[model samples]
Target: MKDFLSLSIANLLNEYIFVYDFLDSYDLKLKDDELSKSFREFFDSLDEDKLEEKGLSIDLLKEQFVNFMNAMTADADTIEELESITIVGGVNKYGEPENVELTIRKGEVICIVGPTGSGKSRLLADIEWLAQKDTPTRRQILINGKVPDKKRRFSIDHKMVAQLSQNMNFVMDLTVEEFVRMHAESRLIENADEKVSAIIDEANKLAGEQFQANTPVTSLSGGQSRALMIADTAILSRSPIILIDEIENAGIDRKKALELLVKEEKIVLMATHDPILALMGDRRLVIKNGGISKIIEVSEEERQHLPYLQALDEKLVSLRNQIRNGEILNE
Candidate 1:
């Protein structure tokens, strides 16, 4: 009866929540009414006699929440561990086939857009299996149209899918030069040192003059961190596919950063709620209730409709550069 009740509750939760897979993929524990009950019970259990007259402060609560989130992600050491990647329309146990099927080509950017609770992260996870592959619920992952052997070195093959989460962090002790160099050192190419130096130079070019390669990551603003992460991932990666989640939240010159990624010719698959990021992709796949509701090529007409001011700004940049370079300005 206990087993049956547990299964019943799980089914009920699945039926209502819609995107239970997304929550589970991100390790976000869903809170139902039972969770409220549990919180209440725990609060009640605290000995009133031992309790201080003062209630819990907001600071204390915030600290506790931060601690909780960190603890949850403690085992997530590398970027790969955080990826909950999945392919579209993967086979599952329910005997029901997935309706959404997407074949992402190499050296292209595919943006995924959907409403809230649309299982975007799950889709990311399915395509890029990360640190938590040890569990029973594994991604039905495939690479280059073949099922990769799990027993083999997954990290090497996984280089194909570089996932950038919303929140990026770095070791404050390492300078930007040192940080990028360390990642570059791991490559197997001949003259690796020279290649590393070139990568750093390229990354710096994209990052711009204001942000120094020697600057500590701790001093960086949210926007700067995002830029650095992009540089690091873009330069160090030999990956064919890059997965980004809610990149618009980084509060940076997102268009410039995205332009750099696109220019690199890497196959980018971003999960974005922002239409601006959505427009950056060659194609947009809209997911709903764990299925693809719409898969459309971003036509030129659609591209023109997206905030025209940004395009105007790019045009102005070209005009100014042409004037300075003394080419088209005279014509």
Candidate 2:
């Protein structure tokens, strides 16, 4: 059991660092390989001798580990569960996905934004398949009261969730309408024509001025491509939870497109670098090094504060450069 806890901690640490490294590159533009390596080497150096010197009893450690794991299990309450998303208390000395607690209410637009290498994608994946048994790694993921057995497909109770990633490709043979209709037919009921019509209308509205229903998706611009992908995901999947990655591609007015999606009140978990999209979210989670560093509530206060702060910082930097280049001087 002591060995088990130690091993679990090591895994959690690795995941944390892995997530951080990935986000660092994407969000902060930092190459942190050397720092990550040092951390890993430091962790690897810990041994049983070090454990004994710390005065931690193997029996006590094992008991705590079991208790921690149990807290992450179904027995924990909702508040207890959401608390797990905060990295400080939920994660143990050894790296394990224990005590993960978060309940994303229905229809809230939640944005997961962090620098590259920060675990935005991983966090999105975790939320999509929270607390499942057979996840690639044995991280704790719980849905409602049960551990989602990895073999089971539809485990989480939150309505069917749809994920629209940057890389999901549309096959050339299928026209845009055909692709969306395929999903509409399956998810909608016997009286789906009205819903289908509404979906079409909504999709068209969201597609911006340039899109036409019959347009072969292949001919669409990059922005149009992104809009169509979003339209397909929004209309086709009946699931209330939608996960999108990097919606702010070069071409599209992704911010407006997302605002339309968010208006529907679906539980949206999106990862992007765009500050505009991040600001639009009801809640913004900052992920780094595989752990959540800060969760900013985009309330009236934050809405007013963050943009101003960022702009001020940018202005200061610009001024500093100008002064260094003799663009301005104390006279």
Candidate 3:
């Protein structure tokens, strides 16, 4: 509170729009010269009788302003800072114990691999729900080694997990810049315009074809839409755990997208069938019959093959671009 009092009124209003709104609520206005003065100095100069008439004193105003700021920013302070997520053993379709205990840490990529309808999505759902042996799988999810409280598990305001499904579509009529700006503003981000620009830049880097900020969100193609959401989820979302269901078919730079998410120190759990993507993970969870069947660590031997796999992937991307351009395949 003392630190806040020392800040110039202009600085406070510029850095925290809430401060401006707080002053506006009380119909408080300052002269241009007063903007450079510290809020404490300005308040000290106010007429006591006038303040009393408004049912306010210097101490009361300061107290109420602090409380207002706290209420406005409470969600930002309470967002969970995850260290690791633990998945305790659960049962399979046959009611057999999965006999698995996996702990995934921040900045670690864990891949989920299995045939379609073999429970990959179920595992993601379990984590998303922060299951406490309640779901049919009987799996338990622990955050930072302890079971998350009901508030953290059920509160929609502060989610610990952000899931990215295979399909991404936008129905909004807003332009790309407007859409991203809306999300940034909702999060109460400082320098929102700068953040929005960075998000759009990163999204373009991931998309197959670049789109302008003026383009309507509904006008974006499938790949463009997926790229935008991936960028948004990576940059603006406070959720520490990211669940991606098969990004290989998104027609974007899948590896770069994962790298961006991991760079943000997020715990990434991707359900992917692409061998290159599975190999990219630090460990792979093999799901079968509605449960985790095995956990395979990415071996050094497998790590040695990524370069080759990446090269092949690049060739495919090149051929894809060539086809999109209507060029003949000479080779």
Candidate 4:
């Protein structure tokens, strides 16, 4: 607290714009020349009559300022770095033991494959809630190989997982740049403009059709919206675990999106039906009867087949574009 009080006004404004805005709320705008002065010095320079007129003394003003900043940014320091997540299996839907224990480390991609309604989403929910034998599945999830504290598990501010579903729609009346900047500001990220630009650029690379920074988020197609979100989550979100559900239908570059998340060293769990997507994972979980029936490691042959699948996917994308452009299919 003392250190914060002694910081120059310029330093405080640079690090916490909320402080500047807080003072502005009280109609206490500092002069440009006062930027070099510390908060304590500024308060000391105020006359007793002025302080009394404002009904707040120097000590009271400082206390209120501290409280306001803390209230506004309470969640800024809550998220912690993650190394791995371990899933201790529980019972299947029929009350039979699942008899599976899976550990996924940072930078690893695990695919979940099963017919629809096979409880794939249940597994994701258990991990998202950090289940401690409490959820319906009764599975236990351990963070960094140990059960997380209640604050880490239950606190909304301490998010440990990021989920990207099949559908992404934006309702905010802000441009793409404005949306990313709002997130960056909330995180108090330094060089926010540069970070926002980088995120948009990366999003365009993953999107099938490129978009400009000034483009309204509401105008983005499904693919563009998903691409933006994937890049934003990979770059800005502190969550270490990323859960993706059926990204194949998102109309974006699925491989590049996964690569981006993996490059960020996040633990990725994807529930997918696409054979190519399943093969892209280091391991695939086969679900049946609401239980993990089997875990299959990507075989050497499967890895070798990835290129052919990707080429075919590219051809399909090309055909889709041609059709959208009103070109007739040729023999």
Candidate 5:
């Protein structure tokens, strides 16, 4: 305890400079307090030789640093969440008025179905961007029944949404671990080793072929790429609402991807054409003529057949793989 109490800033600079960013984000400045003052003075008169002579250990420094940070940022609730998002009536593309009013709560999944150019993506964009009658759809979005402010709309750090678009192309030449590392570090997640491992594990569950940390991002197939991003978004992204557009286009496991996000208690809004994908939602909106024509809550009768549908989908995927491998079908 004496050695820990006497830990000098020189030791921290020499060995634990990586913690500087974490400290800076929480504004953990040293001042008149005994420990902070001592640390401040030690830093002011940093001496490498004296620091070593004092027998200060990196473990002690980190322990003190963590305690300081935890005390600094302690809140009744650290996790950010939205109670619900409500979309009020907005104008459609034909300059006609839409009479749609829908509310989506946390842990609920909603699917959007429409033909091409029918405004499914527009509705999603409205929810994501928090449209205040500003975009093409002229939609009014509310969070917890009130219009979201400009700070909530523009602040990237406090983002309310995460999107998984149709394409999952990897332009970067990085390993899987490196890519997850980049994202984890950006959020400054504590215990990265455990978190990264959990993310990789969850991603592997959704992908047909398991990929390791050393796997090159560019070499990952479409499904693997989508699965990786979905896992990353679910595990790391602070955004409570996750938007998926045509996820089946990436050849991802539609149910698992939806299940992953839904299980995380995130509000999932997806625009899809596949019946299997659409039926998975608790409720779905059907759009026609650039307006939400109807909202249908999925019945127990539909969910009853999901197991059969899942088996059929899996078999279809197997057939697809076999055909791609140049195996001929037997009639």
Candidate 6:
């Protein structure tokens, strides 16, 4: 289910001992009055010959144990084959119905554009809660063409969406290295040191200024903090759905930030007003009157203008850097 291939015997026995109840029917007892040992002790003391003598098949037991482990550890809240997230219908601010149906799938960047007070944030909220036609918007969200289970809607550990908001404040007083190390340890990632190093390197690339791992997370600049969080989320977070609010005003380099954030298998949805971020999406959702008025595919003509826009952006970045360096604006 959740990668039990590396699970130890101790871990397996501790996690799902109920699966071993079938052993009693085969005359192999862990709770013998003579031995009076724990299940783990019984397993460790018994050899392959002893197991065979007790009528237990080694290969068959191994296979059955793996199957049991898979079934036991699999999270019922998560959908393995999430082909698409469909939004059936929603309401506008005027209490009018939205007649649009949208599907967001894996490996696609969908941008949301709208004026102030439009339902852009509301739409994101609906997706985050996996709404079931219950909210004010009256929207129904579906996973793989079916309504998501109630467990996913309320479960804390099994979040489908990983949201990256505009503001990220580190309440903990740990250094950047310590912060990342904690996340790596929580994920039980192999080579945590290597992964932490890589995350720091990638974060520096996104930030306008580089930050040292020894620096306190609170000491980091706004751009550095955002960059670090983006890197951390990309590498460590297990949530398959990546949602982003407007990040254009943030001091981080938008291009590298997007690169570090987008995953091949993730469903990336962002709400942005910046032209560059808007055009970065494969398609843009046009929000009007507090509803998704239209969906616009990136025009081929606009695609051709990316290079020109990028060149201008680079120039602007250079100017911004000069300003940040206390240099006078040149005519």
In angstroms, the error of model 3 at 7 is 22
What's the lDDT for all of these models? Answer: 0.57, 0.55, 0.86, 0.85, 0.75, 0.76
| Candidate 3 off by > 4 Å | 1-74, 78-80, 249-251
lDDT value for candidate 1?
0.57
Q: Tell me, by lDDT, which candidate is best.
A: 3
Residue 134 lDDT in model 3? Answer: 97
Model 4: worst 10 consecutive residues (lDDT sum)? 72-81
Query: What tens-digit string does per-residue lDDT give for candidate 5 at 1-331?
Result: 1333355554544454444664475344444343433353434444445545666444444566656544334421443457899988777778787788898998898888888988776777777788998887788888888877665676565577788886657788999998888788876556888878888999999887788989998999888999999999998888888888877633566678888888888999888777788778999898888778789999999888888887888788778888988999754
lDDT of 6 by residue, 1-331 (tens): 4544344434545665544554544455554352344334445455778778767665656566556556445654354556689998888778788897888887678898888778887888888889888988889899888988777766554577888887658989999999999888756456899989999998998888789999999999888888898888887777767888878545688877777666536777888877888788889988888777888999989888888888888888889878989999896
Query: What TM-score do all the candidates reach, one by one?
Result: 0.57, 0.55, 0.76, 0.79, 0.73, 0.73
Clash tally, candidates in order: 11, 29, 0, 0, 0, 0
How would you encode candidate 3's per-residue C-alpha lDDT over 243-264 as one tens digit per residue? 8888855568888898999998
lDDT of 5 at 253: 65
Q: What lDDT is reached at residue 150 by model 4?
A: 72
lDDT of prediction 4: 0.85
Cα lDDT of model 4 by residue, 197-220, tens digit: 989999999998899999999999
lDDT ranking, best first: 3, 4, 6, 5, 1, 2
Tell me the deviation in Å of residue 275 in model 1.
2.2
